[model samples]
Target chain A: MSSKTANPVMRSAAWRISLWATLAFACGTMVVFAFLHRFVASDIRQRTDAWLTGEVEVLGDVAEHTPKDALYDRVVSEVAELASNEVPNRLRSEGHSNDLVFFLQTDAQGALTLWVGAGRGEAYLDAIRRRPFKPDEPQDLPVAGSDAPYRVVALHIDDGSIIYLGLSEHDELRVLRNLRFRFFTWWLLLVMLGFVIVFYTTRRMLSHVREITEAASRIGHTELDKRVPVSARNDEVAHLARTLNHMLDRIENSVRQLHTMTDALAHDLRSPLTAIRGKLEMSLSAAAHGEQAEPIVAAIDELDRLTEFLNTSLDVAEGKADALRLSKSELDLEELLRGMADLYEPSMHEKNLRVRLTARGPVRMLADAALMHRMISNLFDNELKHLPAGCTVEFVLETAQEQAKLTVQDDGPGFSQEILPHLFERRVKGKQSSGHGLGLAFVDAVVRAHGGSVAASNRKDGGARLELVMPRGLAAENAEPRPVIIAIAGSGKP
Target chain B: MRLLLVEDELEIQTLLRNSLQEAGYEVDVAGDARHAEQLAMESAHDILIVDLGLPDRDGISLILSLREMGVSAPVLILSARRSVDDRVKGLEQGGDDYLTKPFAMAELLARLRNLLKRNTPATGEPTRLHVQDLELDLLRREATRSGQTLQLTPQEFVLLEYLCRNAGRVVTRSMILDKVWGMRIQPDTNVVDVHIYRLRGKVDGKGQPPLIRTLRGVGYVLKDR
Candidate 1:
């Protein structure tokens, strides 16, 4: 509740998984549709080519055997029987939409002969003449203006006797057309079905990943006890769960280590500190009562040093002891800095160090005021401990043009740049450092909690400066912000 | 001075036992809840230090279960399960104090002594939570966080109590599912969130602090603040 972390703000694993899975499913659906379309079309072409070839062969045989007049006589006689037998009954009984037949040639007077006008009209002959064809010796003429195609063959008799045969390609063309329609319908349904499956599966998978990701993110933000749920079976999701849970184990261990270390420091150091305080109190009382003034004064100074160390040690223990105990609220940073200055002024005066505080308008921030209060106070302690004699300790709190800086500088002896990087490292007591070496460590921890960065260096004018830099709004508000939300995981899976 | 400690880890418990006795507190040690339960039933001790991950039973369950059979002693929970959810869970189950482990013996003693000092009268017959006109009668196991009262199923009341007790801390998705739902549904289901929303709508009516607010980047926090 206290920390403003963006760990859970990014796209969820579930959403990512679903997105990719759905995309893959759509691509596959397209490929299958294309393949199906081409397949049905190719099949129709091959069958039509074969039917046309068959019509030519059958007509060529009749021309080779039967004479022209006999062919005409045969056509005239065969209409009733062919109607009954040659076509499907639906076409036979229904005459207008039926396959038509006819023959045409030059008459004995050299005019065109219209001999065999059995079932067809001139439209049939006109259709025969108009269709495009190659001059193969057994080429068939194409039929026109029907749901299915028809082919015609013209045979020249020996005495210039023109004989012809007409065969309807209605059935084969119908089959091909029907096949294409059916294939389209079936394939369309298949593709839709595939998409639905992909959507559901992807959504489900992504949602699973989302849950794990959320859990992992929670663990990253110091919820060390949180663990990713591992399914009893061993799969990738389960593997991820197991791995995260393993990491959580270490985190919990380290968290426990931190607490134990704090407790140990507090308990271990308390007795020695109490003994020193007791002796100093006794010495001070004895000095007031008797004439041993110098020894009492020396004892009092040593007691001050011991108490200071004890206080710092207790602070280290508290930092680790209840780091999880955070009381968060929305408060302005400007006011908080003022409060810190007021609390630390007496200590600064005791050391004869002038402390300066500055602020403009309100700078709103969400944090645990008590913790932040302690954090800045620790920084002031460090400043007082390391400042040069007669040098004022300046506490500068300023925000200009969107960037906020909090700097604590001392007039005391400053360290070289080499010791700068290690100042914030835990337990690293530098030459000009204060309070058992954890003052900067505690400051670093608090800065990190605010999602800010800390740097310690010598001032351009020969002093020690600890600067904490953060965006005017918590790094979160200043960031290219997005709502911490996502489409639930695995929503896209089939 | 003598304390019966129930913990699974030999190393941690041994360190704790040695540390407690060194700090001048007598300790009766049990590696798991079963042994501790037997020892606790038979003997007398000043206080108890319990670990949740016991071999026989969850330390919380053991404590609550013992309370059912009338074991009236202050219990101090020392666990590695250090979520606010876990802490709230231990307290809800009749634990007097909850301390996440890697704790100093002195702090644990301070907490134990504090519990020893503040002796609350046990609710012998009628154990219930009453806030304002609302009464959650544990004996009858009924409902009421505010004026709108209803008879709840046992499961529902258990869930509500956990949420109500941890009213100001962020409760994780796993916490609700693990403790309340208890591995019934697949972890992937939004049942926890769904049920929480349903419960919230029912409990926090008209206008209120939304008893449960999602913490955006974290879990759900039960805070009116």
Candidate 2:
């Protein structure tokens, strides 16, 4: 394979896989060969040794087939020329490579002493000189430093004498050498095959892991909504992908929440700062250096706005974003709305706008009284601020089927189209140009916290309309709310 | 009255010096808590104004450090953070009074007067004090203008009390909010103005003389004739 191209056979996974397979195959084959060599080959060698020993015992029998001297003349005539001299040139050793040395003995009277193989030396004759024949059993010798294993078998004849056989380990040694040579060649081929398979699998697995790792790093810098892709199969990789995506979803939510908080902070702070600078500059220009009542009025206004923004922002951040704790104290929704109307009556008169408030029956509601009061007040403030002057502002509340509906309508125009899109987006509403835009934002937040809905739209009669729908499941019956003049800060709803 | 100021920001120091000198006080400025302590101990001053977040050592403990060394001059803490917990903690740590930063010079002066009055040794009763035609009869608990009695409401009486106590000095709304109400009022309403406008009618209603002068961007003060 070319190095430039991806080839499993040349990779580490391929190499390891092939190597393991080859080892497994070679071990199994070697075990089978080991048993076969122990049983079949050893049997053949034993029988050959016995037959040779029987033949050597029959050397005494050569006297029956022919005269001893004649047999010797025939044997020498047939084999002596080939065996007596060393042949100089040949393809293989003409000598018996591992042929046994055969000895003939008959009551120590046979003429044939011992005929070793063509390559045999004097060691066989010296061994026979000490003992002419062996007993009727095979004998094993510890051939030190020899790689091949063999055994020797001795046979007893009817003449009360014995013939012995010597078997060398050359045949078994040759078989093992051939087997080893074959093993390496096949091992190399199997290793290549295994490497191809392992490399393909491990590479795919690593790519999936790498993809998830990269995804984790990207999420910190990029959009949190981005997720890691999962594998087709439902496995460990797929599980990781699902988990990573879930984590990203949570991170996205938290990031969104943080953005909202930052906007809230900017809006809340801008109010006080604006007031401070305005009052301070106004006084400086007026050249009133001491005990100016106007500064006190301006400063008081700034301080109040500053405190309100801070408290509301704190509550929202704590997730108690509900302005004013839920004053579970039973409240008369009608009375609260009436009091709100009375407070706005003077402004209504000045603006030449008539306010008609319709209150029905002691409809009590359980809610954060002050927060609800603020919510309605905010709706009223919106109409006063967003609409042009000299328009009729209507306030009405009704309880039907345990649901209370509080609606405010004005003959002036509703919110501008551009303002509608971001009305509830904290500081996104232009508080500087449009007085603390958080008033409606605060209204939205508070109403939602109390499990109510607030909707604003153009009234059918060419005016702005706001409605707050609240369920009365939480309120206790017959509890009354006291009438008090809620302070409507000139800044916003409350 | 000569005063010592321990503040880090130059703008704030300038604001303090300008307002204090305008109010006729000899002022000395210190940049750190250690220097403030040294200044307070070295010189006898009518009042001390300290700002937290000093470069060396915390300013809260500096007040305690001064008290430990027998410098009983009232130490007023002015910090940028107005958290309730921090304000309570400051008072608990031997600070005579606390005000958040970005405060008007009027507010700072008012607080300084309050602290000085609270800590000022009663060598003798201040039975008679005059601001132009206005006179407060401290022993009899009455106020008069050119020997004519003036009718004042409880709040009006209290307001006049603060103005008489620090005649010729400016007071800010924040000081009024803290001292008069004991509760921080929101900065959106004309509640303070309404009260001041009403009180003006009672104290200077006879047309004898205008005892309360309005210092725009600052606070109300009673000037001595």
lDDT of each: 0.57, 0.60
Each candidate's fnat, listed in order, reads 0.00, 0.04
Error of 2 at A211 (Å): 38
What digit string (tens of lDDT, one per residue) describes model 2 on residues B1-225? 888888886655665676678778899999998788778878888888877668788777887778788877777776644232344455746548776544565666666766777775657766787776778777676888777788864556677887787677666665664566443433333345555666787787754567777765456777765
Candidate 1, residue A282: the lDDT equals 39
Which ranges in model 1 have alpha carbons more than 4 Å from their true place? A1-51, A64-177, A215-243, A288-332, A343-370, A381-416, A427-437, A449-494, B1-225
* Residue lDDT tens for model 1, B73-123: 788876554233444554745448775443333346556765776555544
Lowest lDDT block of 10, candidate 1 chain B? B182-191
What lDDT does candidate 1 reach at residue A102? Answer: 34
Interface RMSD of each: 21.8, 7.4
Compute the lDDT of residue B80 as modeled in candidate 1.
Answer: 50
Per-candidate TM equals 0.50, 0.41
The worst-scoring run of ten residues by lDDT in candidate 2 chain B lies at B182-191
Candidate 1: docking tier:
incorrect
